[model samples]
Target: MDSDKDSRFIPVNDTCNMLEMTLSFPEQLEEAYQIAEKQELIKINHIPSSIATIGMGGSGICGNIVATSAIENIKMPVFSFRDYTVPEYIDDKCLVFAISYSGNTIETLTSLKALLDRSLRNIIIISSGGILEQVSQKFNLPHIKIPAGRPPRASLGYLLIPIIVSLGKLGLFNRYEDTIKEVIKEVEALRTDVNADIPVENNIAKDVAIQIKGKLPIVYGTGEAMGVVAERWAGQFQENAKVLTFNRTFPELCHNQAIGWEDASGITDKCVVISLEGEWEKGAKVEQRGALLDIVKGKGIPVLHINITGDGGLPAIIRAIYLGDFISIYLSALNNVDPCSIGGINSVKERIAPYIDKLNLLS
Candidate 1:
C-alpha cells in the first residue's frame, strides 16, 4: 500500500486530524488581531529601549517571530528568551512579552517572575489560561486571552497575530491587516495545491514528503524572515511528523556547517536538505549560499530549494510555512503515525509533573 500510488497519504487518520486546525488558521489569526487591536495597550507614552520575549517551546516561537520582524521593523533591539533566567538587557525601560500557550510552562513562568523581580515595569502575558494567565491577573499585568483547543504548535496563527498587531500599535508596522489577509489567501491557495485531493505527482508538498520519507530533514534558511520559518518547519516535523531534524542558517553555516557536510559519515544518504530562500535574497547572501549549495550537491545530496516570492511580505512566510505543515502531515501518513498525538512529549510532561509546583506565592 504505497501512499503515492494509493493517494491515502493525505487522508486524515485516527489519533489526530490536524487538517481542520490548519483550515482554521484564518479565523484564529483574525481573532488574535482583534484582541490586540482592542486592548488598551499600556505604556503608550514610553516606548521600550529594548524588547524581550519570554517563553519556551511553541509559545516561545511567538517571540522569535516578533524578534525576526522587529529587527527589520524597528531600530530598537528585540529577542526571545527561553531559559529560566531573564536576559540582563531587560530593565524598566524594556518591554517583555511573556507567552505560554498552556500558561503553565515552568521555564516561561520562571522567566516571567525573574523579569518581575528586576522591577521591569512593562510586561504583557499572552496565554490560554495557565499559571501564566493566573499570575498576570493577580499582578495587574496586561494580558491577552486567546482561544484554546488545539495544541500550542497548532495555535501559531492565534499566537502570532497578536504580536504583529501589537507592533502595529507601536508604529513598528502598518500593514498587519493587509498582510494577514494576504497570508490567509496564500495559505488557502497552498491548502488547495497540497491537499490530499491533489495527486502526489502534481503536489509539491507531497513530492517533498515522498522524497524525505524515513530520512532526516536538514532545513536551511537565510538570516532574515525565512530562517524563522525554517525553525517552525523543523518543529512541525518533530511534533507533527514525529521526526528529528537538523537546522542551519546561511552565511553563518558557510563558516562551519558547510564543510561539515563532507560525506565522512554517510550523511548524504540519510538526510535531505530543504533550503528556504526568500525572493528578496541579496546578492552577497545568494553568492555565499551558492558555494554551500555546491558543496552539498557535490556530495550527491538531495536538495529542495523553496523560492518564496511576491509582495505578500509576512504572508509569504506563512505560505512557505503552510507548505511545510502539509509536508509534515503527509510524512506522518507515510510513516504510519498519528500527526495529532505527541506521546513522547506527553510522557516527558508526566515524568516532570511530580516536581511541578503550585506557585502559590504568585497568587
Candidate 2:
C-alpha cells in the first residue's frame, strides 16, 4: 500500500467531507420516499402505453438503472435516452419523463423541447429548478421538484425515487412502499462497511479499489440488480476515479465476449475482473459467474468477487451502488486525482460549443 498520501489527490479532508455527505444517501432516500408517497397521490390522467426517460450523465445513469431493473416487471416498455433528441416514435402513447438534476443539462433540455413540441402524452419533469422547471410550469406539465445543492451523482436517490413513485402512481408497480423501506435499511447497513472512518484494512470497498489500481476494471453482473450495479460501477470509475472501466451483463456476454477473452492475452494482465452477485431467481446465474471467473483467472487476470448483501431488491441494489461509489472514490485517491473535478469533460464541452452554436443556428 502506498502510505505517503499524494498531494494531488482530492485532499484527504475534502474526501472525508464528501464521504460524510455521501453517507446521507440513506436519509435522503427516506425523505425521497416520503415525498414520493405524497406525489403518488397526484392523478396521472393519461397512462401511456410506453415509458421513456430522458437525461444525461449521472441523471441518465439513474434512468438506466430504473429502466433496466423494471424490464421484467414493467408491462409497458421502458426506454432511457441519453442523447439530445427524443425518439421519433414517442407520441401520445408515450409517457416521457425529462429528468435533469441540474435542470440545465443541454441534452435533456433538447430532448424535453422535442417531446413538448410533439405534444407527448403524460409528460412529467423531474428537476431541482432551472429552465426545465420553468418550462414545465409554463406548459402546465406535471413536475416534481427535488431538493437541490448536491452533485448530480450524489442525488441519485432524488432522481430515481420520483420515477419509481410515478410508475407506482400510474399503476405500473405495486410493491414500491415495501421496497422503499427495505432499500433504506440496506443503505444504512452499507455505511458501516464503506464509511470513511473505517480503516482501509477493514473496508471491503477500499480493498477492492486498491486491487484495481493501475488496472482497467471490467465489471460483470448477472441479474437485473447486478447489471445495473455493474453499469453504475463503470460510470463511477469514469467520473469519480477518472479511470477507464467497462461493464457487461452476463448470459449475454457468454455469447460473444467470452470467446474474445482468448485473444486478450497481453491486455488481460492489465485488467481486473469484478463479478457482482445478487439474489437471482435463475439458479444458473451463479454457475455462470463461477465459470466466467475461473476462465478469467486461468488467463492470469485478477478477479474480485463482491456479494450484494441486503434483504429486498431495492435495498440490495442500493447497497451495491453504495459499495461501488465508495470504491470509486478510494480509487480516485489512490490515483492521486481530485475526485470532484472533470477537466477533460469541461475541455470537451468547450471545444464542442462552437459547432453546437452553428448547428443551433442552422436548425
Candidate 3:
C-alpha cells in the first residue's frame, strides 16, 4: 500500500494530532513575534562580553540554532550548555538565556540554581511554567512566559523567537529584525505546499518519506546553519518517526566518518544518505561536501540532496528545519506510529524519577 496516498493511514496513525501541531508552525512564529514585541526591555548593568544558552532536548535546539547562527553574525561568542554545571567563565558579564519549555528539566533547573547562587544578574528565563518559573518570580529575574501545555519540540517558535528578538533589542544581533518577517511568509508558503492534504504527487515531503521508508537515514549537514538542521532531522526522525537515525556535519565527517564507508559491503544497502546543502557554505566546503557524497555513493549507499532554500543564514536554517519537520511526520504515517508519543523516553524518565528525587538536586 502506498501510505503517501492512503487517506485512511494518516488519520488512523496520527492519533494525537501531531500533524496539527506541525502545520501550525507558521502561526506559532507569528504569535511568538507578537509576544516578543510586547516584552519589556531588559536592563543590565554591564554589556555582555559573552553569551550562553542553557537547555536540553527540544528546548535545547533553540540554543543550538542561535549559537550556530551567531558564528558569522554576532560579535560575542555564543555557547549552548546542555549539562547541569555552569562553566566557570559565565560571570555577570555573560548574557545567559536559560530555556526550559516545561521549566522543570533537571539539568536546566540545576544550572539555573547555580547561576542564582553565584549572584549572576544577566540571566533571562524562558519557560511555560515550573520550578524555573517560580524562581524567576522569586528573584524578579526577566522571564518570558510562553503558552503552556505544548510539547517542547512543538513550541520551538515560542522558545526561540523571544531569545532572537531579545538579542536584537539589546543590539547583540542586528539581522533578525527584518529577516524574521520574510521567514514567517516563507514558512507559511512551505506549509501550504507540503501539508497532508496535498497529494504525494505534489508534496516533496511525502515523496522523500516514501523513498527513505525502511532504510536507516544518515543526515549530513554542511556549515553552521545546516549542521544544526541536520541534528533536527535526526531527532525528529527518532522521536516523531520512531526510528533510529544519525546525523553528522561535513568537513568534520570527512576527517573521520568518511573512512567508515571504505568497507561498507553490508551496511551500504540498508542506509540512505541525505545531504543538506546550505546556501551559506563556502566554495571549499561545497567541494568537500560533493567529494564526500561521491565517496558515499561509490559505496552503493543511496544519496538524496536537499539544496536548502533561502538567502542563507537564519532564513535558510528556518526553511530547512520546517521541511524536515514535515518529512518526519509523513514518515510517521508510513510507519504507523503516533508521532506525538515517546513511549521509550517516557519509560526511561519514569524509571529514573526515583533516583532523581532522592538526589534532591533542586535543593
Best by TM-score: 3
Top-lDDT structure, candidate number: 3
Give candidate 2's root-mean-square deviation (CA, Å).
Answer: 3.6
Report backbone clashes per prediction.
0, 1, 0
How many clashing pairs in candidate 2?
Answer: 1
- Superior by lDDT: candidate 1 or candidate 2: 1
lDDT of 3 by residue, 1-363 (tens): 345354632635665678898999989998998888788866977679999999999999999899877865688899899998888889888999999998878788778778878988788889998878777777788888899987787788999999999998888887877867877888988988888888888888888898888999999999778889999999999999887999999789999887887888878779999999866567889998888899999988899998887656776788889999999988987898888888888887677656445435345
lDDT of 2: 0.77
For residues 136-236, could you state the per-residue lDDT of candidate 2 as single tens digits?
77777777889987778878899888888888767885577676777787778888766766766677987898899999999998776688889989988
Which parts of model 1 are misplaced by more than 4 Å? Answer: 1-6, 354-363
Candidates' lDDT values, in order?
0.78, 0.77, 0.85
Model 1 per-residue lDDT tens digits across residues 1-363: 336474557545635458667656667677777777887666656767887888887888778777766644556788788887886767888777888888878788777777777776588788888787778777888888888767898888877887777767777555667777777788777777777778887888888888888888999988668788889899989988889997788889999987687754756688889998888887899999888988888888888888877532577777887888888878887887778888888898787664447444264
Q: List the residue pairs that clash in candidate 2.
A: 183-315
The deviation in Å at residue 16 for candidate 3 is 3.1
In angstroms, the error of model 2 at 330 is 1.8
Return the candidate ranking by lDDT, descending.
3, 1, 2
lDDT of model 2, residue 212: 94
The C-alpha stretches of model 3 lying farther than 4 A from their native spots are: 1-11, 354-363
